[model samples]
Each structure stands twice: as C-alpha cells, then as structure tokens.
Target: MTSIPKTSRRDFLKLAAAAGGGLVLGFHWESAEAKIMNVIHGGTVAGSDISFNSYLSISPDDVITIFSPNPELGQNIKTSFPMIVAEELDADWTKVHVQQAMLDTKKYERQVTGGSGAIPHSWERLRKAGATARYMLMEAAAKRWSVPASSLTAEHGVVYHKESGRKATYGELATDASAIAVPADVKLKDKKDFKLIGTAVRNVDSKQMITGKPLYGLDFYREGMLFAMLQRPPAFGTKIKSVDAAAAKAMPGIVDVVTFKNNVAVVGKSTWQVNKARKALKVEYEPDGAAALESTTDHDQIFKKLLDSSDPNVVSVKRKDGDADAAFKTAAKVITKEYQCPFLSHSPLEPMNFFAHVRPDGVELVGPSQTPDMARNETAKLLNIPPEQITLELTRLGGGFGRRLKADYVLEAAELSSLIKAPVKVIWTREDDMTGGSYRPAVRYRFSAALDAKGNLVGYKLRGVGINAGNCTREDNFPSGAVDNLQIESIEHKSPITTGAWRAPITNFLAFAEQAFIDEVAMAAGKDPVAFRLDLLAKAKTTPVGAIKYDIDRMKGVIDLVVEKSQWGKKKGVSQGFSVYFSHRSYVAQVAEIEMKKGKPVLEKIHAAADCGVVVNISGANQQVRGGVTDGLGHALFGSLTFKDGAAEQKNFNNYRLIRMKEVPAIDVHFVNNGIDPTGLGEPALPPTGGAVANALFKALGKRLYNQPFTKQEELKGVSLGERL
Candidate 1:
C-alpha cells in the first residue's frame, strides 16, 4: 500500500452563508500548526464567482454536489474521483452530482493531470474530506436526539438510531451540521464495506455527450466572440519573411490580419470565415535555417553518424552495474541488434482550440488543458499581469495523450485576445495541428547481450539517441535490477523541431526494442520466451542489483496470468508471441495472435493481463487497456511521421495512416485483483503491444523487421511467404 502524508489540525475553518440554505464543506491542510485557509462562497451556477475552496455541498432537497478537481481527458478521472468521495461519505450515488472545479492552486494542491498521477495523489485527501462531512452530520443528528454519536449509524445519506427507530436525511440536518466543527480524526470504511468504489458506473456526462450538448473546448462559445485562425511558418527554425493579406482582407466576414512571431493570424466573424481567409492569405518564409533538414533520410544519416562515432562528449552514462567489460570478455555467445521508430502525432479527435477574454484588470480563458495552472502562469507572464489576475477553466478534452500538457495553444489565444481587445476563440484546423510540430521525437536504439556456454545471460548494454526529447533512457525501467553487469547510455542530438511527450513517452519505443531483442536471445538459446522472462523475474526477486522500483512478484503475477489465459504453448495452427513490461507504477503483459491474410500480417486477437493495484472502474479499466492495445498495434503496423525540409510530410489523415475499423482485432482483457492502492492505467498497457506483435510476425513470416511500420510499401503488395522464408 502507498503511504499518505499526515496532515496536522489547525484553525482552518471558514464558513459563508450559502444561498438556498445549503451547507458548504471547506477543508484546509496544515503542516506543523501552520494554517492556510482556503474558502469560497457563491451560488451554483455557470459563469459565477463560486467559492473555490468548497469541494462538497448539501442542499435542502437531498442533493449532494461534489467538485472533481482533476482534468478529464477521456481517461474517466471525472467519474472515478467523485466515486472515491461518495464511497467514504456513504452517500447515495444516484443523488450525487459532479461539477468540474475551476483552476485554483491554493484550493487544490495539484490541479495538473498528466502522467496518470491524479488518482494516487487525491485518493487519501478526498476520502478524508468525505469522512469529515459524514462525521459532522452524525454529530448533528446525535445532538437532536439527545443520544451519543457512537450509537448513531449513517448509511446512504441518512442517519438512523435503530434503538429508537429514529432516522433523519442528511438534507434535513444540513442546517445544524453546518455549525458543527470538523473532526480531526474520522473513521474510514473498510474495503469490504465499499458500495461504489469498485462498481462500474457510467460517466456523469455521457447523456450530454451522446445528445451533442456543449461540453468540449471546441463546443464552447460566447456572445460577441470572434473567431481566429493562424498561418504558421512552413517549416521549423524559420521565421515569416513577409505576408500578403490583400486578397484575404477582401474576403467576406474577414475582420483583421496580423503577423506574430512565427505565424500570421486571420480574425473573422465565424470559424468558416476565418478558415476561408486563412487559405487565401499568402505568406513567404526564410528557409536558410532549415536547409539541412530536407528529409527523414537526412535525419537518419545524422543518427547513424552519432551511433557510429565514439564521441565522448555526446555520450552520457545513464546507469551501470558491476563490470560489463569483464563479463563480455569470457562470454561464449554475443548478439547485437539495431532498432528505430519514426516520429508520431497525438492527432486528438478535437483540434486545439481556446477562448480568451483579456481586459485591463485580468485575463479569463476557458479551454481543454492538461496543465491549467501552468497555462495561467504562462499567460500571466505574456500579458504582464499577476498570476492571480488570470482565471482559467478546464472543459472536457476530446483527448490529451500528453499533447495538451503544453500551453502553447492557450498562450496563443490569450495573445490574440489581448491584441483584438475582445473575447476571441482560436481554432486549429486538422492540417494546422498535424504540421504544428510538437512531435514525438523519432528514436534509435542499439542493444548488445552476452551469454555463457550454458546459455545463461551475463551482460547487457543499450545505447539510444533522439532529437530534443530529453535522453531516451530510463534507468529504473524493467531489466534494470534484473540483470547483472548492465550498462545504459544515451546521446541527444540538437534539432530545431519541437518535440514533446507522446503516450508512454520513452517507454513506448524502449520496451519494443528491449523486449524484441530479448525474444531473439531466447530463440538463439532454444528456450521458451515466456519461461525465459519468468526465470529472469524470479532471479531479480531473489537477488536484485539496485533499488527495484517494480515489484517482481507483481510482475510475475501478471505474466503468469496472461500466459495461462492465453493458453501459451497450446496453439498448433496459429502463430503467437508474448511480451511483458512495467511502467507508470503498473505491470502489463500482452500476447498477440497473428496469421497471414492476403499476403499481409493480420492480427487475429490480443490477450492482455494488467495488474494496476485495485481496479477503480472495471468497465473503464477494460476499455483503457483495450484502447491501448489497438493504438499500439496500429502504430507498429503502419504509423510513421516523416519530415521534409523541417516540415511534417503527413498533414492530415489522408497521408497519415491510422488503423481502420476493419483492421481492429478482438481484444480480451483480464486484470489481477489485489486490494492495493490503484496505480496508473493510461500508459502501461501500450509499451508491450508493439513487441508482442513484432515477435508474432517473426513466427509467421520467418523475417525480422528492424524498423517500425513492419509492413513496408513493397511488403504490402502480394508477396509469397515462401519467398521470405
């Protein structure tokens, strides 16, 4: 179980009279008797100055409203967080309503939601808040009945005294409960007593989403709001030379055309008008800086140069164990392999968009952002205002995948609003978004291993290189403490193109390379892949080299579950491959079944076993694992993002190939149930999918694919399997 920090009790209470005689619950955290009160008071309405400090409220009509503090980006945090509170409060789930909390740094210790950290960070805090409320309500009921609080029992928003057959709804006692002081220590429910925590509940806004209601950032609108579109530079590392806006200004509904640092903006009355004018606008760029970045071929040459050259300045040691040089010297067998993966785009369903209203006193912005507080601070710095002067709200995001972590879009909206001197909305077209270039940096990996005469592994080494996307190295990753005489080194090359996190980040490609190489080593030794990995895990459990961040027993549990569920070594007619990886504090194992269809590799089914501690929502957890498998397979089979002249070659879906509906396979997901605190599920399931599929393809076609997008253009044609064999 994860340990939670202890909070001290102090004078952190402040109550304001709420409209409609509702009861507000305000919680403050104290460390060593230093009190910091965070309070808010206002009506429950859209676009109102509601109190930011209040997280829960009870009205006179038996309604309980809970504010969810994390950002929702289709990972279902909005539903999961409130369920935690309801479980502790013993409130009726059906009578509870959820509201998205505005960005308030003081009110929430952390408002940013990325890396799948929200649930773990808020689990203990929210449970305490709910328990505190329930305690106050029980005290009020005991005072009214002239009985001890210990004799009262609260269940489903009602306090009952079985001895006297007396009961009162929480709403009926809201007025009296509001005056009671909060208790420093409250008893929390045991796991066996939970009713809503592990149950599957539909998303709170599912009805609104299906009915086409306004919920997403693109769906936001305001009266007198203008629409704007940007025409960014054609390539990276280049600035706009000149702009010809005469033809665009003559278009209907065009408002104004202005040039900014790297792009030109076209403001209009509606999105259609702005899009039309943007197409008509002409712009020239100075391409001298990006002259060397002509193609992916050039980037590959740079990577090869870095890989072959033994430049001490470029190489940085990430981790080392024992003496790899001595172990390799006496090895009987040595194997080496090189792997590469292309850049990728987030390509969320909804393109980047935000609405901003800048004024002399402050700036107000509403949009879908993973880091709302960071956006507020950056906008403040750009507008020359205090961070408190900027107000930011989070809407439902179509999808984040770590792309929304960057506040460039929010900053752009604020800057445009300040210039236009009115409320404005900035929208990015599909083409603009694809070419905007905060891409998942392409990476290269080289691996080497040594084995003794008995086929026992002795030494391992890995070197990686990438562009701008920090070192492509994770020291605490799997196979770290598992292997003795291990060394990991990384080199980063300079590139003007912007790069950022994508899905699992470095683990995405690293797992693919590492696991695939492990499979090759196992095959060379004539050993079962599943058994080989299990042996290593068992060895790590017994004698680990350093601090093992992952639990080897938990890792082995998921692997054993997957192997059993998948019926390993029992299939006679189909080819199958297995892989296991750990990341983001979660363990996942996957198996891919593949066969030939029309001379191309076709995935028939996928079996996955996930051990992410306790499953919050069974249905949502299943979908997350399923979606991750599909995403990983699609990218591994045919997804690639190339560059030409420092510009992305694939501008839209037409050029960028994604997995079609017909290509999806039946995915079977299973979870290992252990009552521990929940870990992240958003990214751990993705890293193993690629390696599983690649190993399956090797079994079917007798070919080893060194590069990603395993099915090349020539391979897509009708080629006989016998020829490759």
Candidate 2:
C-alpha cells in the first residue's frame, strides 16, 4: 500500500514543537488521506500540516488540537470530534483543544459536517491514525531503552517501558519517533479496552464558548476587509430590473453598491453601515414567480389533495417489500393516519457569513459550513477560478443543523467580493438568513397498516408528499415483501423552497411517520410496540421492508436498549413515547417522557440509545445526542417555513421559532458500548425525536397530530397540534 507521505503533516508539527507553544493545525489543502497511517496514531507535541480534512493535531508538547469541521451552533462537536482522536491517540483527554479547520474538501471528505455522520464515519480512521502514531513512538522508545517495542505500553500521552518502569511524555519522543517506519496493520484498541469511548468527556471548546472568544463565522474579520449586505428582492424569483445606487453611495463609509442579476449589494466599512445603506437603496425588480404563486392559506386542503390523488411515479425509490396492495385487500383491519411536518429553517445561532479576499493570483475564503468541499467547488466556480486558487479557511460554526449544507451564501459572498478585486466579508442579516435560507420542506405522510384477524401485520402502504428533493414527483419507498404485501407511493408538490439533507438520512421525515404509525397500530392491536417491532424486525430480516433503508437488527438493538432503560411498558401518569430509526450507517433509539405543562405537552425528558459502532469520546458522543434531541424538539414543537407570493414569510426569529434553553429539558443519552465501529451523532438523534414525541403526544390525547410544529394554530381546527396536556 502507498503510505501517506510522512512529509506534509509532520513538517508543521515539528515547527510547532520548536516554537514551544500550543500547536493549531488549520488544514486547508483538502484531503489528508495521502498521509501515512502510523503518523496519525503516534502521540506527540509535533502536529503535521494537513489538507482540509485534518482536525486533530498533536503538539510536541503533547497538546492535541482538533480543528472542528462542523459549526457548533449548540451541538458540542467542538468537544465530541476531538474525543475520538483522544481515544485513539491515548492522549491526555484534558489536553485536547478543538479549533476550526478551514474549508478545503480535498483535505476532508464529507467534512460538510452534517447528517450526523462525523464521529461515526471518522471513528475507525481517527483511532487508526492515533494508533499508528503510537506504534511508531513505541518503536522509538524501544530503540532508546534497548528493549523490544512490544514491552512498551502507552497510556495518557506517555510511552512506558514496562521492563524498567521508565516513562516518557509524548513530547520527549517526538523527534526520534518521526524517523520510525510507518507500522503496517497496527492493532486497534478493542471496545472493552476503551477508557474514553464509553465515558462522557467534557466538551473541549466549552471554556472558549463560555468565555466568548473569537469563535464562529461572524467573529471572523481580517485587515482591510469590507462588509457587504444584500438588498435582495422582496419576493423569490424577482429579478433586478434596474438599480440607482446614487443615494446609497452618498452614505458615509459606503464603499460600493452594485446590482447583480437578482439583487443589489451594498458594500461598506462595517455590516451596520451596509445594512443601513441597503435599506435606503433604490432598485426596480421584475416579479417572475410570484404571479404564479397560490394565495390560498388552506395548507390542509392542499395536503388532502396530494394524498387522495393516486399517481404512481417513483421519483426516487427508497424502499419496497411484499405485495402491499394484495395484503391490504385481504386484511381484517386497516388503520390509516395522515401526518404533516412543516418546513423548517436550521436557524443556527450565528447567521451565515463568509470572508473573501479576491486577488489576481488566488482568492481566500472563510466561513462555517457543512459541505466544505461542495463550498470550495461552488465558490471556485463562481469566482471563475480553479479550485486550487481559492483557499477556504474553515471557522468554528455557530451551528449547522444541516442549514450550512448548501454553499449559495458562500458563493454569493465570494462572487460579489471577487468582482470588486478587494477583501470583503459578507454578513447576512438574521432576516436574510431566515427568509432566504434553504429550508426543510413541508411534508405530508399517509400511512396505512393492514392486520390479519389474529393481529399479525400483513401489509403496509405509504403515500408521501414533499419537495421530493429528488424530483418534482413523489414515489413509493416501503421495501418489497418486507411485509406480505407493501405498496409505497409518492407525489410532488412544487414550492419555491430549496431542500437539502437534514439531521438523519434522506428519509428522516418518512422514518418518523412510519415508525410512529407502527406504534399506533400496535396499540390498535393491543400489542406491545417493542414486541410488534420485533415481530416486524424478524420478518424484515427474513423478508424485509420496502428497500431496506433501515437495518432491522441494529434497530432492534437500539430499541431494546432504550426500552430497558426507559421501562417502556410500565410508563404511567406521564405519557411515554418510544421510537427507533436507522440511517446514515447509524442506528438510534429514543424514548421521550411527556407531560402537560400548562396544556402543551412539555418534553420533560429524553432517553436516547445509539449504536454508532464505536464511541470515540463518550462525553462528546452524548453531547451530540443531547443536542440532536433538542434540535428535534424544535422541529416538533415549533420549526416551520411559510411562503406567500413565492417569498418566505418568516423573516427572523420572532416569526420563525426555535427551542431555547428554557424549553430544553435535561436530555439523557446512552451509547451502545460495543466495539462495532462508529457512525455520526449529529443527525441520528434528530430523526427519532419526532417519532418519540409524536407517539407520547398520541398517548396523552388519544389523538394524533398529522402535521408538525405541534403548535396552537387556527389551522389545526379546535384541536391544537400543540394543545396543552
């Protein structure tokens, strides 16, 4: 195997060691995979220079720095991602610091840092890197002490020669250790041997967060950088016809006000000045799509129309099993429920911002985003430059929640600044960030379960409607023959809203709709949800659901863990809800305890269990689960995007709601401490929260909410979706 050239990563670490200060690896080259495996695992104070992918760096001082790829918003990735390296490197956990890696995709693949794929996907690789480094260090120690390397053991950033009882800090062996050959096929620590994987570690960036350091996109500024804010069209698809920048140009500190094809941008010395000047600019827009937009407010009627219209078009085939139509006709009982989940904005704490310095040779870009590689490609294309010329420096994001997945904002900022041949920081006001944001599509799910006379589930049919993300048309997804008969269909409801991946996999909304419906079906059959789920899982393994979008056994494992910890069947007084989901190579289970707090079903607590393969940092993993649950709470309790005349109605936080600390109950997270491997914590917990909360709400009212934002709106009729307990 061609090993990673030891030159790139180690070169920088050696320099940092010589300086005698904390070493920060701000990777920007793109992919660091070319580096050898052994260099990564060895503990050291010397950190190597990495492409965009490098997050964790060990100093000659043995201080480990993890440049967090994902934006923090509130999820504790700053701490969690580092925990993985700490686990593999066997470094002193307390010495770990999570900084921000720059946006360079070649360096870090999928560093977009959403969909809950980070820790899980990186688990094995990161640990292996750390282990490789450790092996080389052992060899160096053996040569110095005149003993075999096998006799030396590593623990807490020190290499110990067991024979002589001599120990050396990681820093002491940094130089000699670099000369050793990269160990081939190193031994990885088993799950049973993990000290950090199963235990909760404090977030490495917590102190910096609390101290209000210069973290997040908005905090990013540099010498001679201008601030630009756009005065976008009042409505979507409204193109700029003409602009008169005379008045705005007179405003003090205003650098330039230029009109692009779609909107007008006001560049000035500060964000405040540009924002103030933007409001005063004069521009004419030709409204395009607004004329075709529906003015009706009856979203319910629209949902009904999509549901009853029978058209079989497989826009994207996700899952299919048995002959659902045949089983439905012969079933003794047919229970159908229609549920609707509204559109939601990610609403990360720090609104989108990017700094770009456009030069004749190359350009520099900086910001927080989920898909860093995508951002690089998009930015490069917009600047009319090659990817190599555009440097994207990743910063600690305030939050991602899948919002940063699309890099339109990054492109817009860079494009505007590149045209002017100057350094500029594009700052999006909360309104633009919200209204102009890419939103989670409003979705409608129709689920029907057929049961035999003996109460054995025979068939299932699902009709789902949304933006399709795949196409304008919806399609069937239930796996073929997973049941005796299964029918899945989809329809398209066009919207101006742009859709991207949220917390879990592509079918997050559908998973919740299906799982929650299954719970209700179990109740109808007077059966335990777990028992019913197990029965389906058993059949699923033998004859599985629509397309096997989920793993039955892994789902069963997480469910069992949650059920055991939650005391599922015995839940009383307060309504208890349970749900399990599998997506993004991760399986997760969640149980939410709900009670009436002044009529609304307050999410009192959440018990979550996840089999993410391996636990890199137990505390960090738990933190992701905790944050994901709360994120789902927001989606369930109050996250929606409304449009009128082809423009988003919610302009800012006041109109678009978010779950605050007051609404956040203490979340309890537990990991399946098996040595299976690792997945991600960012999104798994989100998809399941909706299912769990909805099920609990079903028990409390004996009424099911078909749509999300379980809020009190005139739309839900008299039975408010968020009616108090």
Clashes of each: 1, 82
lDDT of 2 by residue, 326-394 (tens): 888888999998777766676777888888887888887787776777888887777667888877767
Minimum summed lDDT over a 10-residue window in model 1 is located at 1-10
The number of the candidate with the highest TM-score is: 1
- The parts of candidate 1 lying over 4 Å away from their true place are 1-19, 28-54, 288-294, 595-601, 713-725
Best by lDDT: 1
The 10-residue segment with the lowest total lDDT in model 2: 1-10
What would the TM-scores of all predictions be?
Answer: 0.93, 0.87
RMSD of 2: 5.1
